[model samples]
Target: MHPRSLRHRMEKAAKLLVIIQKHTPEVDCLFAPEKGEQGHVVCEFSGSGMSRSNILQLGKDLEARGYQFTRKANPWLGQLSYTGKADEKPTIILSLPVVKDRVAINEDTPATPYSFKEA
Candidate 1:
């Protein structure tokens, strides 16, 4: 990738991070390239209360501001791709990391042993 193009991408990513931070104050945001990938700038956010609906609403807000964005969904995760210009396809990929709550098991709890009988 050309240095100029990379610089442009970095700038765009920074702009996006500002917008995200303004809207989603509770979430943490970052602007950086994907590991081992060239010419790709990704906007990553992770924190409690970062739900899919919240992200979709953010995308809508961005679109209302004249920015083009698309939401990509997965079974357990989702992201928004911001393509402000034709040449910059998905210049920024907004990622919301899904964190699952873990329950701690108490060792003091007694477990009952069960035996299965052959039918």
Candidate 2:
């Protein structure tokens, strides 16, 4: 069984997922595909270089909802944490699924590159 806190985190993640899906569009999905690791929020973005305006907009939207980013990788990848709770807690991580758009197709280009079951 998962810890209660983890459950809470996932619940929060679900809410964030709604927020991300509502905000992100496929066209602008360059830097981020459909989802990426984020606090309680699985998010998608435009690209590294303003490829999609949704990313910037999402930042603003997140701010409006009272979530301040904690850390990251490079300038555009890594982690996110809630405000005020920075001092406490061990660590918070958001696991977002890799976007299919970024995946490179092989010579055949199967419909689904990754499969849970091998036939």
Candidate 3:
């Protein structure tokens, strides 16, 4: 491995640490090598209160800091499981809802869509 590349990776890791520390204290952050991959660093964090907007903003922020973000999908429930990877390395796993549940209106309720036809 080239010394320059190693140094650059170290710098990135340091910067990521600082960013994580500054933005999220309640979240648990982990830095490790990607599974089945070599010469790559993966950052995984898990937290609550994660929404789609929040995740989008987070992605933008990470991208600005030289990290690529991808949102993961939920397998079982088919919902957003809140897991994303940055540069295929820095990954975020959130335990929050990306979409809200549908609210069912009562059948007896008068609230309904109205339609008018020209006479």
- Highest-lDDT candidate: 1
Superposed model 3: Cα runs more than 4 Å off: 1-10, 34-56, 77-119
RMSD of 2: 14.1
Write one digit per residue (lDDT tens) for candidate 1, span 5-52.
677667766766666666665775544454223233454655547666
Total clashing pairs in model 2: 3
Ranking by TM-score: 1, 3, 2
Per-residue C-alpha lDDT of model 2 across residues 4-111, encoded as one tens digit per residue: 656655565555555555655442221222122322223333232323355545545655665444432221222221221122111222222233442233323222
True-vs-predicted CA distance for residue 46, candidate 2, Å: 7.7
Clashes of 1: 0
Off by over 4 Å in 1: 30-46, 51-57, 76-90, 95-119
lDDT of 2 at 84: 13
TM-scores for the candidates: 0.45, 0.40, 0.43
TM-score of 1: 0.45
Clashes of 3: 0
Q: What is the lDDT of residue 113 in candidate 3?
A: 22
Which ten residues in a row are the worst by lDDT in model 1? 110-119
